[model samples]
Target: MERLAKGRHHLANRTSLLRMISAWESGARDASDPYRLLLCEAYGKSPDELGLGGGTEHVRSDIGLAYLGSLESATSALGELARFDEMKHSAVILGKYMPDALNAACLDWLFGESLADLRLSGSKVTSQDVAEVRTMTENLDRLDRFLGGEQCRLMALRYLRERVVPALKASKTQAVGRDLFSATAILCELVGWMAYDTSRHSRSGTSPRP
Candidate 1:
């Protein structure tokens, strides 16, 4: 598979590629994006034919309503939610709220076990990173106030998905992890508020996307 990937100009470390292949085979991870393309090329099959693309749509539509138990889970959930919003799928944009799901999520959040300290091997997160996220969130909040949620929601989702999610996955000290989590929570809350505003406007038949 590494040789095949290399043939397709996708250079990756042999050990890492082997591990990724193992994960994909065992269903521990989904083959995403470039890997999906590479695998399709190597196997001469479409992503749907390879069973790699069918489940994502369902998963994305179902994301963001569950109670995430840890920082890692929270990060993954937030990333998926942002991706779902960014896709602008009409079904998701106008989907009805599930009262039962909201109740269950609230219960789980209230009763869930405390998150363990994050200690992953990746880029280090710092106070500066947390501050940057907070600053961005504040700016986006101002925009939401001035221009409305429909105008600023996508940008907020994009930043959260592209920048904040990766930072949440990076290595950080306990203190920094807490700070980062707090900053991320603020951003997530802002995004949720924006989503709510957009939904309300949509239901009133007054929301117009430009």
Candidate 2:
């Protein structure tokens, strides 16, 4: 929820700072340690060169995988909850930036026929989808359409992990930057919690938190 200028740490350069700022737009998983570590590496610094220390690429990926696991946990938690108020309150808090995405997510999570259905319901594809289309980025206008909006950084992440890097890997280019896939794992979890929790709370007749 914090702005780039308002986030906890400040980098010495605009590029690194923009990477962090881009994390928010991309989604939490894309911002994972591996991704940030790679980003740091791109900047000619190890993760330790920055304050991240051992927040290496692998470590960040582990974190993201763990959060991806939590998505199911949240779903179970929501299904077992007796009140919508608690859930709704949680969603409202999380919707600070991606309100529409979070809102639709919450609604689908609670009211959907089942958890499996809920999982498949939304278009919360995120910027990772942009990764799939980046090869065509010679057209800047198309790039703008693909990576534009509040979730640009989120989508930008996919461009690295899912689309570009994979293609590069096919040609054996080898990825040298962040493990943005893991970051998306966390992003999905965060939005999942926000959506299910908020919708649950709202359905339970609980007033949203002040």
Candidate 3:
């Protein structure tokens, strides 16, 4: 509350708050905009650069683990800031990692850790895994309207095959398949961005209404 209060009260603090919170999930350059670009950048690094993945041993040694945990708390506190809308949660949440520059030095605590835990637990939640939740999602039309079905499909596909695939490919375990699929699963929120960016309502400044 006090931290958020400081952010609310002071402009510099607000910016600082934004930077600090997002840093856990993204890095300094990220935590900004044009999101997918950031995600793409983050994809290029080897585990040596990120120093994550492999096995339970890696998870234990990860320095970002604590930061990732704090990020979950910060995300909840900054929920409003993270949410551009239901579909555009990319601006506010871990959605910053995909389809973008992606080279930032951050991890979206909960999303990253949960995926890690699933890997450690031997669950099949890979980056490429298909999510049943999205299949049953009711708000997809807005996403389709924003990015369009073709673009959205392409966006989702590129998210998997281009970015996360290489990382998974380098993995020594079968978790690569799961990571490919799970990485795709992480797109649900961004898919919501599809509802916003691809829809008529999203035409605010980009494509005005006729």
lDDT of 3 by residue, 92-174 (tens): 22222232212222344324543232212233343333333244233344555554654653344344333333333343355
Best model per lDDT: 1
lDDT of 2 by residue, 130-176 (tens): 35343333233344455543243234333333443333222111121
**TM-score leader:** 1
TM-score per candidate, chains pooled = 0.64, 0.19, 0.22
Ranking by lDDT, best first? 1, 2, 3
Off by over 4 Å in 3: 1-71, 74-78, 81-101, 106-132, 137-185, 192-210
Error of 3 at 171 (Å): 31
What is the TM-score (0 to 1) of candidate 2? Answer: 0.19
Worst 10 residues of 1 by lDDT: 201-210
Where is model 1 more than 4 Å wrong at Cα? 1-55, 58-61, 114-119, 200-210
> In model 3, what lDDT does residue 160 have?
31
Q: Model 3: what TM-score?
A: 0.22
Each candidate: RMSD to true structure?
A: 9.9, 19.4, 16.9
User: What would the per-residue lDDT of candidate 1 be over residues 1-210, giving only the tens digit for each residue?
Assistant: 556665556656879878877877786556654677777888899766887653554564445556767756666666665664555544346655665666777788789775764447778989999999999999999989999956698788788878988887888888987888788877877777787787643222211110
